[model samples]
Target: MGALGKENKDLTGVAIGISVLINVIGTFFFPRLLMVSGKEYGPAIIYGDYKNIWVYILSPILGAVSARILYKFLEVTKPAKPEPWHCNICNHNHLPFF
Candidate 1:
């Protein structure tokens, strides 16, 4: 059990490290890509200018809508039936009382 716990902790740490690395890479690349595209609205977004009101307003709205759609899609696609818990002593499917 201790070994399993250590393995789980290591796995979690690796996942977090990978996530941070990806975010850092995206942070550097996404802005440069926007700048290269000659989109004036891009820099104005982080810098906060009056001209980028639409960008600021619409970004969260679109993000929320997309997130909701994705959540619903995942919920619908998930398996309908869940595996039942089994009692080891009796070898029967049943719920355990704590």
Candidate 2:
């Protein structure tokens, strides 16, 4: 016998848990891709709140500065650039998905 029954999880329960987790993250934490995220965060412009329009100008500058500061402070690792891809089956050296 095992020490506990907690290790076993049914497929449906695991799927549901993952679905809830993804939805929660997407709702609260995850920002969508570039243009979509910009549009989603554009309530000030969308709602005619021109008073707060400075957000469009300031956010990029502030975000860049904060990112640089965090990069220097945390010593974040950057991924290496991928080398030019050469497909074996296609017998071509062209870019992937192009």
Which one wins on TM-score?
A: 1
Candidate 2 per-residue C-alpha lDDT over 1-98 given as tens digits, one digit per residue, 9 for 90 to 100: 23213323334376457646755676565343232236635675678766745655675688669756854564434456556788798777865453
Report the alpha-carbon TM-score of model 2 versus the true structure. Answer: 0.30
Candidate 2, run of 10 with poorest lDDT: 1-10
Q: Report lDDT per candidate.
A: 0.55, 0.55
- TM-score, every prediction: 0.35, 0.30
Q: Which stretches of candidate 2 lie over 4 Å from their true place?
A: 1-49, 76-98
> What residue runs in model 1 are displaced by over 4 Å at the alpha carbon?
1-26, 32-48, 76-98
Q: Compose the digit string of candidate 1's lDDT tens values, residues 53-83.
A: 5654575578569756854553423245655
Q: Cα deviation of 63 in candidate 1 (Å)?
A: 0.4
For candidate 2, the clash count comes to 0
